[model samples]
Target: MEPSNDIKGLIRQSPPVDVSKPYDASTLKGKTIVITGGANGLGSFMVREWASHGANIIVGDVDDTAGEQLVASLTAQYPDSAFAFQHCDVTDWDSQVSLFEMAVNVSPHGGIDIVVPNAGIILPDASIQFEEPVLKNGRLPKPNTKQFDVNITGATYTTHLALYWLPQSGSSPRDRCLLLVGSLASLCPFPTQTMYTMSKHAILGLFRTLRSTAFRNGVRVNMITPYYVSKSNMLKLPVEAAFLSGTAGGATIEDVIDAATRLIADEDIAGRALCIGPKLKSAGVHGVEDEDDLMAVQERENNGQGRAVWECYAGDYDNVDAFVKRYILLLNAAERVKGWFGIVTDIWSMLRRK
Candidate 1:
């Protein structure tokens, strides 16, 4: 898919932030934050911020040396508070689960207050800048296996493990969150950073799916797609590194940091991207209009008896509208059949077992 125009449009529309007031840190007090990839970059920064605000922290990272050092520093600083570190490979489900279990063991009174699945890496070919590349411009060297393992699979595993290990999935009013570290790539096309972009976009979709599927379970999921977190692997190139590189301008490390913090504070926002930059208010991400429109269409269909389906199958509607209606009808019919089949299968299986 040609990502040039799409990425350009998204970057032009930066994340919108409410800079009317500074973020309140009091909300984090007494909370327990579990951060994957807590050793460095934005994840580490978040850990420190949460810890300073009286939140207990469980730092999970593959870099044991750096991770342990951060923990030691926090432990010394917050002698009265709780802080610990665990060596974890976020790509591995078992390792992520172990991290969650460890967090629970440490904080029995409170389950994981918030989970930040922030571990990610840039593609290998994209990792090297264009100073004197052996390969031609615009074309990356090769596929990056490490990027896929760490960015895509790693982020997915971390989120699921957090939900599984933590006692946050319920109908209670308790505040529990799963924040995925998505990228601007998730919103639009990123030409060269194939693996990185693929992973990020997939993570965004995963978060959205989990949000709807786990709504009854009370597992709130969200994502933050910073344009270019400074001094990090997310953006090793200059601002004009790629064709859609204009979005990198004016974005700094501080911008991404503030944006992430603001995301955590804004409880009303979810299932949307937040393009963070140096200033809090300058951030502008996509809204829920598309999703809302789709939902509204579905509700209309379900409210009226399969008429929407008939209209769709009749093929008299406009292209987009007809496609949507037909898709919804097919989905509804499939769901009905599946539900009945499930009931019958369950009964048969029970009888056989007996």
Candidate 2:
């Protein structure tokens, strides 16, 4: 049986994104940003976006050549705004720490305002086609790759390093934010892409849980989920296979610059996922609610009262100061408990003697 002609026609359609709104350059004035995997792909586009927004950008990527080239280009274009590029492997702790420290040193403000953990690789083996051959047979097959370690684990390492560095860099935690570059795969379950999907979904959960972990620290965390971003015009397809090929080529780039532009416009929208796509509904939304409405809902749910919850974990605190304070409090409480127990025991013993 031949594939339907409609599928071919649908592939001819241009990808969705409005280029009408010119990006605002002043969106990130006085802000400093660090982007990982920023030499190419979505990360690179973000670098330009942030730079154009008047942000001092520090880009980290494994590709030295491209990373250097990008830095040189940015430096030539925006010499006033500090733009530095360093080779960083997200999976490596040393590299991450070095990158952050370098960024802090270069920024005139002494701290980074935004840390975009955007560095990741989509391993060729990540495709889900092997398990569901029937569904993927008619569709173009994706390369089988290690999507989890590169996509999910890489992101984790990046976030962890950012968390580790931010508190120590002499910056108020409230002023720092972590923007995790997630994907549409994280929300929807597309066939044959389970690894990428699962990892991305897990990332969303991590960002959600991070709110609780970072609440006391005053750090805000968020994620951006982008769908098929255009990278190359040549790869633009007239069929499903061609469409997949275009994305794989990383040829057709998306309006990622615009997405970052929009991100800076809103402050109330935090600890949520911002999905980018062709249609309005295509931009999937989650975890966003007005402050008053949220409070009202919480009040009703809690009978007009609400208590904040804190997670007690040893890993969150880096200093002996917090630990010593907690230990002393616990010890003091224990002493009081012992005194009361002794009194009760003495009363029991006295009764026995009687």
Candidate 3:
């Protein structure tokens, strides 16, 4: 049974997605996807893959040069699909609003099907600096909060905008998804990086909190927690210096893409998380890994094939006590009634300002 009367999660979760199983890439055809921080690296790679599968892709990023170059490259190769780039600084709310507005304007389907909040950065040992400030002129200067703002605030804005716009999934019906990019730091402690770990934990928290409720908008909310040095060694982040670099058994893009596509194309899935890490030899996959390694915590798929993607926190929000059930029902009711008066007041305020 579902956890509540409505806006509830699944009663059960199937095994980790069988990437070998053929999925209908045809489902992606005619759909439109919006990705933030998509100028390079994982975002750029995903753009190429989705565009090749006949999806309209709108990239939002601060890097105009890389964004335009990516769009140009894809437009040339995939003439059938549409590609557009909008310069977006995710930390700025207005900038992100403009990006989404542009997506709606250019979308062939007149709606967004998928959104990836993929823009993130790592400040080498930033936490230690902030916590233990050095005396400059006998006074500590204001610490930089750029990392927290971009990773947390920007992503929060993206999620809020996604909730507002995605409920109206165009004129005709199609799948709606919010694909969140989290990190291994979300599940395990990063002894060296405190701030980064905190931000990822918040992302994981956001996914957990939204998944059960976001379903009310017919949006499937999913997250991917990838290991450091994942895919082409995460060229964007300085993970190479963070350890766990090449041949250190980080996840391949193939597995990340597979897990992502499965969560997206498979409409039945909602409110789930996937961890992408190294594909280890079955013999060594268990005992060989550190206890804290997220990869070691999972059961391998049948046939003992070396694989990456693993399901995180198998609880699907299905088990609920009566008090919890009633609480959720009340919460839904409150949300249904929320913001209307505030929205009206805001509109009037805007009109008066004009």
Candidate 4:
């Protein structure tokens, strides 16, 4: 028999997010969120927005000066809201553990609702001399792997901890989530920045695999992949040069914040990924034309003004391989059998220890 044309079983289509529409910001109120590398750049931007919406935030970063300054400013502005800064080196596991402990200690409810593994770095020297050999006794020197350490290992540590703590803190399973920050490099290879590209690809892989089964743990997993962002006036020349050379325009910090807010505020969304790029004034959605009728309808609804956020391949989980499908089914079956008895026993054990 000929192969069927139905791939929907393996990958379901994801609904497009209406960026022009506003989400309920009130959903973030009173939630305690932990963000790694929340001292500057996109992390700082998210911190301000989440705090403005009444979320208590714990920012972890190695930049003590910037972290302290940011915490002070936010604390003063939102006096009733909790804001804390802890020194965190993502490359170090112990440092991350300490940061999580501090976050829980500072939280009013003694629990963490959301965790954002946003810490990342791209060293200039590492990228510049990625393949250059250091001549020492004619032996090939060990290539620098700090980029992987911070981007992959650090993210892994955060993921492990988030799985443990998020469930412990929330009264409802819907409140638990892990938000991973990836880059356009996650989807496409950047030859100039090999280490950075490799690291992001690893993160994208983690996001894909984790989302497939995170629901079994009652945890929601979402990710945001952003294109180059030109924030400073000094960087505009290079950004313009890239644009002139046929490269796509960079996304804005506001665009990223908007995408992230939607994920944080909406509890029904899970196993989703959003890619943020430059805004466009076209009447049609870019890069999605598999369904001509649906695209035409979307174009009519949008009219013009193409949004920066687009859903990535989020349906792959719907039709997973046999192993994954069986694993998820087995987990669901076990949960049904265990029921409240397991939960009660676990609670009782906790209470007795306390």
Candidate 5:
């Protein structure tokens, strides 16, 4: 007889996160975390919050002044924990590899437990556009790769390093995670920044791809998609503010941080993503009021109460075709066999060490 929840096993994914539930923050204690773009903006905020909870944090950024100063303050505030800074220009391969090496050397456990690819660049660029072709000397201008290079290429480099280091580093399920930070542009289009929007959308693709097989390496892959959010003071920049003005509610930095906190703290949440945005009230015209109210379209009608985070893209595999279902089932079967093989290998290694 077919099992009641056969598809659940086939998917090989953790259940949807219950945001109302609580998790242990001290789980992060002594866990070494390496983050890119940690010198300023959202990365800096996360570094501060995580450090307070006793996690060892290694920050990598191009801003030498800000990165060094942030590390100095963290060292003072959390003397018992670990904090290190490495000058990493994400666009450069050697710079990032050096950053990873520094993390391993300075980590309290001599390994990285969590890796967050948290660096991104978003500028009002009409270079990859048509309204203004940006002709150079009355000719077509070359399309710059700034947005793709940083947001896409740089992030992929971080992911490559994490895949190499995390499996050897983690001791348990709670100890391994590759947390990706995608932006509001990941879901929808932006006006002037075509490349920025496209790059964030590519993040969604990366998340899906990794989640499918990253678990075989003993690492959990998760992503956070935050809505139009202001970083530090971006009054001088035109992109962030322009988008929020048209949206129903603007996502607060606090909410974005909160969303990421949930994913990082909850070890059981694998292959899941949380979308953070301005909290809008639940609408009144619903049959089942909160069935899938986390989606933005559902919140568009009402304006009373609100929430910061919601589980987004939870239905990707929920509805699939026959070929996909069969393929996933085969993959799950192989994983089961491999799981048993890995258990034997681990037992043998432990006895050998003794």
Candidate 6:
């Protein structure tokens, strides 16, 4: 897709990532991060990784026992890092509000630098066959939408809170980011998992829309769309069957973590989506005539390794509508107007009042 006219300069395709290169994970030190559904699976792993880097982490999850254990482990491993766990039911607004409040209260800076709306659910019996039972007495029964409530509604609540709190975070604008967790289902069709598919698709839509405008809030928004990972309970029999039938294997937890780490560590990266799947040799740059030739060149330039993480939808921001272009232009103009003169005028006004 062509770059949107308004975001022409602001948005560009992400450069090919070199996973083998070393990154100073310490760059995340002292930042306050809040994550929902962080008791197990990917969320739990992220908590450990971020804490190891010295980030103050607040995890909210419904699993009290697991969440407490995770927090205790991290606290013991990194005594210098602040770690807390709060009981949260993402489907409820009050619960989520309390979770955010707790995060701020425990934060070393009293503000949140990052928010991960990672809470999601997929019921084994979520499909229409189980949820949409036959009508009784000519009246249709209510279908179960718990999947929607947790995945879509919960994510929406988290996003709303992030927008309200992230700007107020003491951290610089470059540090303020929202990392959303989507699924391969967001892009592909899941025939039997109707609710799960719908919820993920909704998240994809949310990510795309926010990426186009999140810059206005100085919050970088990115997404991770992982193919089925064998570790999660959400990956039911149907998912496994599909994977077995296909030539490709399922993704691994390490692969997902690798992708997540890249997004979290790179401050300049914004409005990008990373898809994590089975590991494969790096394709090298998109039009290289010889794989061996490209690999040799890449090795000389920067030692490279095979990668499972690939960028998707990197150009959605380019070529936007006229309204967006005008809006961006106005913002740029306003910034330019608020130069040194604006600062001086504010100082003079304060002196006169004094």
TM-score for each predicted model, relative to the true structure:
0.67, 0.62, 0.79, 0.78, 0.82, 0.78
For residues 2-78, write the lDDT of model 5, one tens digit per residue: 32332334546788887656777777888899999998988998898889889999999999999999999999988
Write one digit per residue (lDDT tens) for candidate 6, span 1-354. 953244435533345455566666677899889999999988998888888889999999999999999999999998987899999999999999999899888988788988999999888575755545787799776778898999999999999999988888464444788999999899897777888999999999999878766777778888999987766655666766765575567677877876887787788777888888765554455665363323323333323544567677665544445444465476675443233324447668999994
Cα lDDT of model 1 by residue, 55-101, tens digit: 88898998999999999999899876788899998878888888888
Q: What is the C-alpha RMSD of each candidate to the true structure, in Å?
A: 12.7, 17.5, 7.4, 8.0, 7.3, 8.8
Weakest lDDT window of 10 consecutive positions for candidate 2: 307-316
Query: What is the number of residue pairs that collide in model 1?
Result: 8
TM-score winner = 5
lDDT of 4 by residue, 189-248 (tens): 877778889999999999887775676566778899988765713135764466436655
Candidate 5, residue 350: lDDT: 94
User: The CA-based lDDT of model 4 is what?
Assistant: 0.78
Residue pairs whose backbone atoms clash in candidate 6: 3-318, 3-319, 4-318, 4-319, 4-320, 5-319, 5-320
The pairs that clash in candidate 4 are: 10-319
Relative to the true structure, how large is the alpha-carbon lDDT of every model?
0.62, 0.60, 0.76, 0.78, 0.79, 0.79
Residue 55 lDDT in model 4?
Answer: 95
Model 2 TM-score (2 dp): 0.62
Error at 265, model 4, angstroms: 1.1
Instruction: Quote the positional error of residue 47 for candidate 3 in Å.
Output: 0.9
Clashes (N, CA, C under 3 Å) per candidate = 8, 15, 0, 1, 0, 7
> What RMSD does model 3 have?
7.4
RMSD over all Cα atoms, model 5: 7.3
Compared with the true structure, what per-residue lDDT tens digits does model 3 show for residues 1-354? 632432242423334454446777768888889999888777777777888788899999988999999999988998888889999999999999999999998888788889888888778567778778898999888877777898899899999999988887586888888999899899998876788888999999999878756776778888888886454535444556446544556677777777777777777677778888886454454455764323442345535656677778555333434435465476664543223234347567999994
lDDT of 6 at 165: 89
